[model samples]
Target: MTCMQLLLYSYPYVTRFDLRRLMGQKIKLTKSTIDKLPIPQMGARVDYFDTDCKGFGIRVSSNSRRFFVLKRVKGKLTRVMLKPYGVITPEQARVEANKAISKLYDGIDINAEKAKDNLKGMTLADALKKYFETKTLKPRTVENYGDLFRLYLDDWLHKPISGITKEMVATRHLNISNQNRKAAANNVMRTLRAVYNFANELHDDTLPPNPVKRLSNTGQWNKIERRQTVIPAKQLPQVFQAIQKLENPVIRDYILLLLFTGARRREMACLRWESVDLEAKIFTLMVTKNGKPLILPMSNFIYDIFNKRKALRENDYVFPGHGKTEHLIDSRKQVNAITQITAVEFTLHDLRRTFASNISGTVVGGYELKRLLNHSFGNDDVTAGYVIHSIEKLRIIMQEATDHLLMLCTAGKKINE
Candidate 1:
């Protein structure tokens, strides 16, 4: 016989419940049997158990009734709530109870095992909730993480976080890479790595080391090429004319600001009116990709674009969203329209790269261009520490690049000279 059968044979007198009877047997607590039990008139829950089912019990109060399993280990009582009445039937509760009883008789503390199961219960979905609560992340970053989870780990989300294995991650990486979405595959693993990192911190002793760590050792990561596309000097004029002809004034100015400032799409997207100081010819960014404050001097042409936007100064955002958020996020439609009009076939970052290429070696030296672009070269460069470009100095360099770009674009036709 099993430990459950052995326990039921021994614990006959421990059940003192004079609960309603079920045929000739010790009333197996069910919906019908539970309804027959007396309501505890003192505003406390009344419990009833089946003599045949060792750990099963039905707890009833005036407001609610629940099924629970009670396991006694080392003379201490442990209770685990199975579910509400209609949620799980009496037969289901008994099945769960017998399982708990089997664990208890095997020299195991049901409470401790349940606690271990709780850590084991930490699903990827639950881990994400904990991660969002604990980590300070950018709003866009948090959204992207969720998208990664939904896209890649939809099947794994409900599984226990601890149950994720290295082999599983490896298979996923290979499968995703096969679809030709190399960057997305790499990003999905990186995002899961962050989730596992958070799990390690939260469940210090319980969670296994992150499974995604094997990707680097196994050489599973995809190689992504950095794009070096730029607008050739001759094509820029026609591109400018196409931008000016487009309808949305906001989009027209936004494209011009990006080309002129070389700012990231998100930085420009989340721009606030307070960050721009037209009089000082400077723009202050509170947050950058590197977590540093980047203050860029607005070119005279970019300053003019801001000057016309002053009429719509009632809102706090430079680009207002149609939704609850203040800033505009949907720039793809406008960008595609501009691309069709100009046939430039460029992304926002391409414009930023075009700015870097236009001025990097010509208008300014390589080191000064790094400062203007807000790129961090490692501290090993002793000469770099000493070289600092002021806003006024950068303003001059920026103006040179803007003048060169606009002069090429506004030339009306391609100037070979």
Candidate 2:
């Protein structure tokens, strides 16, 4: 008998084996061959990272690591890896594997994906967020824009951009006018036009056209009555004397710079030390209402103020706040205090208007004035329209205006003995 025949009679698990028979001769079995045969045993349990299974399985070992794999009743294979001896207990692995197997039996796949549907709409709030991201506006400007949006357009923020019509915009104008008749309607119209254009760009051809183009208004409702806070042009000397009387060096220099340069209140208030170029004698307008970078050559008066500021400059801000890192954010209260004590009724903002008005009468034209004051230049339909203005002409006009202010300041000064 062959080795298979000998083992088959003794072994219970052996079922069948094929062997060639010699012609009319019986095959002989080797005892050593039959004794050397080994058989596989029943399946073992698996425990890995809270994984547990029971079936005909595999015991896998790699680099001192051990794991188990088994076929489930659903004709799918599952793996239960034994946690490293110390890092995680085999008991934890067994628990996790049992949970996974239960989920598999229930036909729930955690990795399965379901289709989702989302709505699309261009809204005022969405437009505002985009504006904040792309627009290079001054900090105060950004703050003011947020304020206007909150105070005036909070309800409209949720309204779809496409739904806003020219009629609605006109109605908003009338509404704002009734509340503050003296408000600058031109500014409101301009802001609205800009916002619509912004929304149009963002909508990417979805918005048919800018609706503000269809709207028309004379912008007469925005007329603001000018406040007479400045001393008469002839009495500029008295104003200079009043400024010099202020004891605080920061306040004194700030006031002098304002009067000399004719920069807006917040421009002076928020001016950083880096923005000032002592060598070039220019203050670069990186942030302005008009959103343009302007280089303003310093006048002698402004240069002197810068000299004084440099001597006392302890912080990065030209006008340092008390125990704060940035410049003095609000000088309105201080300006108000000075006006009250001096019996002057004009606000700090009025000073800017005064500067523009006072300089307009001289050789300074509209464009030069706009560049200096950072005012927006309008086209054919707007007042204070300026075009094709260059900095060279502005430099000359600014230098003359500053010199005039400086002469006024020094005329009444006491001679040091």
Using Cα atoms with residue i matched to residue i, what is each candidate's TM-score against the true structure?
Answer: 0.69, 0.53
lDDT of 2 at 36: 30
Note the Cα lDDT for every prediction shown. 0.78, 0.60
What count of clashes does model 1 give? 1
Which candidate gets the maximum lDDT versus the true structure?
A: 1
lDDT by residue (27-101, candidate 2, tens digit) is 111223212323322232211221124431223222233333243546656444434433444455445446655
Over 1-417, each residue of candidate 1 has an lDDT whose tens digit, in order, gives: 543333233344333342223112346686688777654433555566776786777776666778777776778787877778777777787787787777777767766666666766789999898899988988878999999999988999999888999999999999999999899999999999988888766666567778998899888889999888988888887788777877877777778888888888777867888998888988876657877878989787778888887776547878666777766767778778877877878888898998888877778898877877778988898899888888899888888888877776777444333
Clash pairs (backbone) in predicted model 1: 237-409
Lowest summed lDDT across 10 adjacent residues in model 2 is found at 110-119
| RMSD of candidates 1 onward, in order | 10.2, 17.5
User: What total of clashing residue pairs does each candidate reach?
Assistant: 1, 14
